[model samples]
Target: MKTRLSLFALLAAATLAGMTSPSALAWNTLNGQKPIVIAHRGASGYLPEHTLAAYTLAIQQGANFIEPDLVLTKDGQFIARHEPMLGGTTDVASRPEFAGYKTTKVVDGVATTDWFASDFTLAEIKQLRAIQPRANRDQSHNGLYEIPTLDEVITLAKTHGVGIYPETKHPTFHQGLGLAMEDALVARLHAAYGNDRDAPVFIQSFESANLRYLNTITNLKLVQLIDADDVNPDGSMSLVDPYRQPYDFIVAGDPRTFADLLTADGLAFIAGYADGVGPWKPYLVKTVADGVDRTGDGHLTINDRRVDGSTGVIEAAHAAGLEIHTWTFRNDASGYGFADPQAEMEYYFNLGVDGVFTDFPDTGVAALAAVPEPGTYALMLAGLGLVGAMARRRKA
Candidate 1:
């Protein structure tokens, strides 16, 4: 309900704020202008996530960056996947060749019985096709696309002039399996870009140890990914909570949670090793409980789910000279914990966020276009006039 303003009105407001001028904006670590829209797993809302098709679609939709969650194969080949578990996102279960790989393994202290990526070679992984992981999303595209390697993803990004946001998924777990991710990642990146700080890439990780290691090796920017469940309401590490406590912390016997990393001192420390923080959106703005709905029907609904904007994380990160790039923006009505995706994005834009990770890159692009910088409105008007002239000429 908050995003009631027309697109033209938003553009006008942005123009008034001098956002149309390149000089008015400070460059982020990516060397790009602010309010960047990163395609989360490559237009994932429309296609099977982490596939070449998805990444290409995101580039076509004008996303500045495409995200790839990196997991390694048994041969130490880096691949794009949401997790090491292949059951949910890939058609591995149906592949009889990989049926033996379907066994229980403790990933980050949780027992998961699926075809793990580490158990299969890259050739074996190529036999499987990516599928839509979410039941609510379109499943028709399942089996149409193969899972892509990190090298393949990087190639696509370079070819299209788009950026790459690669997250080292479960680094500590991968290291335990005798496959350290950071060195491989660094080698690939160095071979391609050669220590270029502004090479349109951001290496991210949930655990600090790997990111810190990467910091020592690569000049490329690093992002620290924070999880919501990692901390309690009282800001203590909630190890009992399933996604709490980074595995590196657990391994090192450190009791700190993701919340500890967001403190002023924490951010200052991160600035020494990392360039930005990619936090879950709630860390920036939180949805408050207003009431509960008891309808005549058996179905129940949340009466109020409006976001209380600007939680100071953005300001704090900026104060520490660390960019704030929040994650998991979906255009769906329910998932984002806000009224609508546009409202949610607008809230962050208002908070001066450096960038966003969105499953719907088109929506993100359109949302940013709505609040166009100073010269954008003039271009839009010129394009409209040209269209009108063409229409009149055609009639003649």
Candidate 2:
């Protein structure tokens, strides 16, 4: 009850202050502008992800941008999906009619068995409904929303006056299917937002070659996404097969791990082609699983880890003239070093990330609002320390 109350109190103050005044707080962001909150998969914490309903809810909750991960259909039309495979995030598993459509295929070197979107036409896809892939989230929203195409998602964002951050999921794999995404994506985005670099779009991909290729064809903003398998107990990133390097890196024999991309030279290479970098959050901050159980949760979890502050990736990216946006903050999951998810985001904001991709946009908005002014920075840090102390005392 105390933790819940503390969170609500912070959110209330944030919302009120945000409504009453224009922000005069100095930010350490690349452009010195307030960090943007991107609805990771459209208020995904509440609704089944990638539904128009989820996106609309996020816009209502004050998200500055909505994200749609794209995969191609059998007809080569782009559709919103986190992966080219459709089984986990849709009702395809329950539909007896599409049973024969399920098969195994290799995606990014991993053999995945499921119903691939490329096997289904847009019309057939319409017969399926979106589902919450994460079992821990709300399940009632399942079977209520239809999968939306890139055109429809673009229209939604344009109508609402919010930006769209679209990730071209598995570009090389899509190309192998003869559904090369870059040209189609460029043409569609150009038609929607024109050939302007300032368009409210940030095209992102994990593969370097595709991003470099996109740099030549389109003037729209692009972000290079950096990924790793996991984080080690000592706060170092873990690099393993498949997740270790970008699939394209393996194919092209680039021989650089995801961590290598965060190095000064790597960020410089990225700066040549991308306006920004989107790294998994672990790459930005240092959180150590030192067995302290800071949150007093009987068992140590990621939340119980110690927050040792920024790992300097943010500053490095900024120094490289690239904005850094880290991701996938969710209220129901992955708070990292803090038990309160909003506080976790606030910590990142204070550390000077340019943007955050969150499943709970309302929480993200509130966290941004709650970030302290320069004079109040110490006060916020003190409050965070007090919370940790209280948790430890409770455990004692």
Clashing pairs in 2: none
Over 4 Å off in model 1, which ranges? 1-32, 230-240, 286-303, 333-337, 372-396
lDDT of 1 by residue, 217-299 (tens): 99999999888663233323344544565689888998877777888988897899999998877677754544433223443
lDDT tens string, model 2, 216-321? 9999999999998877756678899878988899998889999999999999999999999999998988877788877676887666788888999999999999
lDDT (C-alpha) at residue 287 in model 1: 49
Show the lowest summed lDDT stretch of 10 residues, model 2: 16-25
Question: Distance (Å) between predicted and true CA of 104, model 2?
Answer: 1.1
Model 2 lDDT at residue 150: 93
